[model samples]
Each structure stands twice: as structure tokens, then as C-alpha cells.
Target: MSASTHIAVVGLGYVGLPLAMALAEHYPTIGYDLNEKRIRALRQHQDHTQEVTAEQLKNSALELTNNCQDLVRANVYIMTVPTPVDSNHTPDLSPLLTASEAIGGLLKQGDVVIYESTVYPGATEGICADTLEQASGLKLNQDFYLGYSPERINPGDKVNTLQTIVKVVAGSTSETADFINGIYQKIIPAGTHIAPSIEVAEAAKAIENTQRDINIAFMNELSMMFHEMNIDVLDVIAAASTKWNFLPFKPGLVGGHCIGVDPYYLIHQSQQHGYFPQLITTARRLNENMSSYVSERILKLMALHSKHIVKSRILILGVTFKENCPDLRNTRVVEIKDQLERYHARVDICDPWADSTDLKQEYGIELTQNPRADSYDLVILAVAHDCFKEDAYTPQNFSREDGLVFDLKGLLPKNEVNARL
Candidate 1:
């Protein structure tokens, strides 16, 4: 870590913005994004993702740019671009590849390129390295170096930030790994774990989310099973959690950038190697189907209340993938809305954190600014955002006498809600 190290962080989204800010504290850091609007917003200290506050952005020395010409000043380029899954649930490496090629053209001798995007094992060394070599006409390790440090950003989480979380670093070689580790250790208080290889670091990050997805999927399956037996899944979890070893995973729509999407990356890589993963595949399927399951359950509850589904008004409490976050990427809540709408139910969504315009554009559903009082046949608390937990947004205030309240996250009082999943 030298004071002269000019680092460029590509892609200023949830992961990159914070990392760039942290790196700027110790080095000359440039936050680069292809989106000109995002760069303009960052210049005005307006982070729509809300990962970095206006105050933090204003006070930081991180340079914001959308142009690739500015990237030549940075010898070390850390890519924080997204590695999302395609419509077929296959690993979409377009973002990663685009960033790699862009950085390759700007590479200098002895320069380092560290990836913070979540990808399957061997992606960095295989796909990214090859792309860099071809684009730059520079041999790996001889002209430039590669590193892998998968991001662990939790959207809406104020705690466990980039500075506090342990960073795992790996590289094309031990010297490259050491260089990457040293750079991250300067800012990360929890320190860095230098992995044996880049592939191990990639595998570790992929499995971290896959494990949680599997656990949550199991809970979702249990919720379905227990619902048939007239049992509350949260209550069962609470009792089971009494055991010291019991994992306290709850049932809900498993969605978000990581837990929902990362598993498929691993599944794709595993299948590429001539082995189909049963448990991982099953977990993904179960979690993916949870939204439809919840929709059917809501319809059943409405029917039990003698309410017609065709014309019923349903108020959905949250639309974001997770609670207390404005990140609308890969949200499974849309599936619930789609399924409910298939029955011709009128679905009105409200999320204090989500952007109204973005929601409408992305999901084609208008966001209700304020949910009307005592006006719906059913209310579904899909995301447990802090705003929804307040006394002002109670379920009783939004539902009629015979209205059914379905608590997807089990945040509501058991006695207050009609049912929970």
C-alpha cells in the first residue's frame, strides 16, 4: 500500500460506492461507472442506492467519472460490477466481462485488477483473465496481475460495513495476493484473509450465500409442511432454536442480489463439470416457488373469508427484495404480485424505501405513496422494513373487519395476524 497508489473502482453501485469511499481515505481513488446519470448523481452526493449517505459522499475525496479516459490515471482497477443471472437463471458474465475488457485497455505494466463481483469458481482466472489478455495483448503475471475479493455487502445494513467486514483476498500469484491483501488491510478494520487461490475465494463467497439459500429453502419447505398441519413455522423455529446448535432460519421470499442469484452461479459451474447438484438445485427451486405458494395461500385465506379473488383489493406492504433497502434488483416480491394478479386481484404495493418511478419501470407496478386506511380485503407484509414495524403502519389500520393479514416475514404479533408463513 503506497500513498501513490491511484486506485479506480469500476461500477459505483451498492458495493463500489462504499469501497471507493473507504479507499479514497487512504489513496487517490476514482469511482467509475458507465452510467452517466449515476456519475452525475454521485457528483451531487445523491446515492440512490443509499449505501453511502450524502454527508459521506460530500466529505469523501473519491473522484466520480463515467468516462474511460479518466481510468488511465489509476494503475490499480478494482471492479465492483454486478454478475447477475440471466432470464434462464444462467450466469450472466456480461458486466464482469465488460469491466475486464475496459480495464484491460487501460492496464499498465505491474498494474493490478481485483474483482469484487460474485462469480463462480475459475471465472476470474478463466473468463476475465482470458478477456484481459486478448484485449490488452498483455500476458497475465508478466504484464499485469489479477485478484479476486468477492463483495459481502448487505443492502440496508448499517452495521458490518466494508471497513468492519473481513475481506478475503486471492490472486493469480502469491505476490499478487499479498499486494491485494495489503491494499485492503489498510482500510478494513476486521482485516484480510489471504486465500490459497483465487478459485478458493470465489468458491467460499459462492457457498456463503448458497448455504443460506439452502437453509432458508428448508425453512420455507417446513413452513409449507407445517401450514398443512395447522402449525406456525416461526413458533416451531423459536422452540427449535432453544437447542444450542439449531440454525434459526425463517421462511419468506428468498430474493435479493446474492442469496437468490449466487446459488445458480454455482449450479451452472457444477453442471458444466458434468455433475448435477441435487440439494442446491432443490433448494433454489423451493425458494423460487415460495412466492407462488404464498399467493395460493393468500387466495385460500380469502376464499375462507368468503371473499371473491377476482375483485378483491390486496395491499402489499413491501416490494424490495429485503427489508429497509431501496435495492430493487432481482426481487421475488414481484412474483407474488404477478401470481396474485393472475387471479385478477387488485394489487397495490407500498414501500417507503423503494423508488416509485423505478418500481413502475422495473416491475410495471405503481407504488402507492400511502396505503388507504381500512380499505382492503387482504394485506400482505412481504418485507419487514423498519417503517412497516412502526405503530403507524399496523395491519389492522389497513384491513377491513373480514380482511385477512398474511405475515410473510412473521414480523407481526401472532395474535394480531390471521396467519403467517
Candidate 2:
């Protein structure tokens, strides 16, 4: 890894933008994305994702581009494209494949290609490597090399950032692994872990999110059971957490780009290898069903309060997949809105972090700029954004005297909400 080694980072989203920013501090880094609007926004220091601040973007020396021609000058290409699931919950490699083809055409001799996208084992070697080979007219290892270092980016997380988290890097060969590890070690102060092989690194990345999905699914199941028993799951969790080795996982809508989607990638690969992953599959099913479960709970409370189902005006406090972020990818909050709409209930969502245009474009749900006070039949705290936690944003402020309050994330006090899950 030379100081002269120019690096091109493909796909400048949540993972790529921060990473490219960090790398630019040490190397000549170029951030590339296919979306022209995204490149324009990055240049103007306006990140709709809100993962990178305007000050950081304006100060960084990193080059931002939407044209593929701008990437040919780079000596090392690191792909951070998204690996999402399709409608059938299968691994959709279109983005990864397309990125590979684009990067492949720009590959030069001795120029290494490393993938930071989450994928099943062998995807780098089997799918991406082959695509690179075909597009570049070069053979793997002989002409150029390949590497895999899965991205561990948590959106809206300020503490554990790209430089703080330990990076896992693997390559097609030992030399390639060391070269890639050395490059990442330059920016990652927390250091890098060189996996034995690319497949192990891929497997590790896939399971990291799958494990969280499974654990959260267990908590979700307990929440459902405790609901039936008229017990508070959070109380039981609090008591059990007193133990020396208890895993403290809270139950809520498990939605995001990673946990909600990664399990299906592992499930797809496992089934391809002739092994049906029952536990992983079931965990995903349970987590996916949480939105409907919450919707049912809200309707039940509405009925118990003698409120009409069809004519009720319900307000959801948040819509982003997680708190303090504008990332709406795979957010299960829409499921609740959809289910509530089935009963002809008017659903209005408000999230300070979310982009109104994105919400309207992606989910077809208009973002309510100002939610009226004391104007709802029910109020649900959906994502628990920091803005929603202030003393001014209580359930009583939004709901009428007899109106119900449902706390999905359990952020509200026990006495404040009529029900929680």
C-alpha cells in the first residue's frame, strides 16, 4: 500500500460516504455513485441520509463523482454497494453485480478490488470475481486481485464509527489479505482482523446480523406471550437482566437494511447448499410479523376504549427504520400503517430525521410536518427518535383525554402509555 495508491469507493451511501471520508484523510480517495442526484447532494454537502454531516463533507478532500469515467484513474477499488433482498426474500445481487461490472471495466493490472457489501460465502469469488474477470478481460489473481471486508456500519450511531470499529478483511490469497489488511489498518484505529479466507469473512458478516435478528425475534416472541398473559415483557427482561450473563435485548419492530434483510441472504445460501435453516427462517418470520402484531394490539386497545376503528385518526411518531436516522430502507413501520389503513383508519406519520420527499417517493406516505396537539384518537411512539423523547413530546400532548397511547419501543413511562409491546 503506497501513499500514491489512489482509492475509488463505489456507492456513496451510508457506508461508503463515511468510509470514503475516513480514507481521504490518508489516501487520495474518490467517492463514486450511479445516482447523479446523490453526487450533486454530496458536492453541495447535503446528505439526505444524514449519516455524514455537512461540515464533514465540506471539509473533506475526497472527490465525489457520478460518472464511471472518473473511476478509471484509481489503482484500488472498494465496492460498498448494497446487497438487498427481493420481494421473495431472496438475495438480490443486481446492485453488487452491476457495481462489479462497472469497476471491472476500470480495473488495471495489480489494482485490487475489495468488496465491503454483505453477502453470503463465495459471493465475492463466485459472482463478483467472475463479473470483474469478464468485464476487464483479465484473469483473477494473475491480472488483478480480490478482497472482502464486510461493512459494519450502524446508521445514526455516533460512538462506534468507521475508524473505531474493528474491520474484518480477507482475500483470495495470503498476500492479498495482508495487502488489504495493511490498507485498512491505515484508517481504522481500532485495527483489523484478517480472516483465514474470503468465505469465512463473508460468513462472519452474514451471521453477525442474523444472530441479532434471532435474538430480537426471541424477545419479540416473549413480548407476544407476555401480552397474552397480561404481563409486561420489559419487567421480566429487567428482572432477568439482573443475572450475571443475561443478554439484554428489547423487543420492537426489527427493521433496517441489515438485521431484517441479512437473515434471508444466509437462508438463501443455506437452502442452496441443501440445508433448510429452520431457526433462521422462523426467526425472520417472527420478526417480520411484528408490525402486524403491533397493529392488532393498537386495534384491540381502540376497541377496549370503545373507539370506532374506521373513523379513528392515528398518529405515528416516527417512520425511519431506526431512531435518529433518515434511512427508510426496509422499515416495517409501513406495515403498521398499511394494516391500520385496511380498517380505514387515518394514519399520519411524523419523523424529524426523515426526508419528506423520500418518504413520499419510497413509501407513498406523506410526512406530516406538524402533527396537531390533542387531535388524535390514538398516538403511537413508533421509532423513538431523540426528538420524540423530550418532555414536550409526551403521549398526553398528542392524545385526547380518553385517547390511547401505545409505546412500541418502550421509551415512555409505564404510567404514561395505555399499552406497550
Task: Give the best candidate by lDDT.
Answer: 2
lDDT of 1 by residue, 328-381 (tens): 998988888888888898999988889998898887888998889999999999
For residues 82-122, could you state the per-residue lDDT of candidate 2 as single tens digits?
99999999899999998899889988888899999999998
Q: What is the TM-score of each candidate against the true structure?
A: 0.98, 0.98
User: How far off is residue 311 in model 1, in Å?
Assistant: 0.9
Least well predicted 10-residue stretch by lDDT in candidate 2:
387-396
**Following a full C-alpha superposition, what root-mean-square deviation does model 1 have from the true structure?**
1.2
Predictions in order: lDDT = 0.91, 0.91
lDDT of 2 at 196: 99
lDDT of 2: 0.91
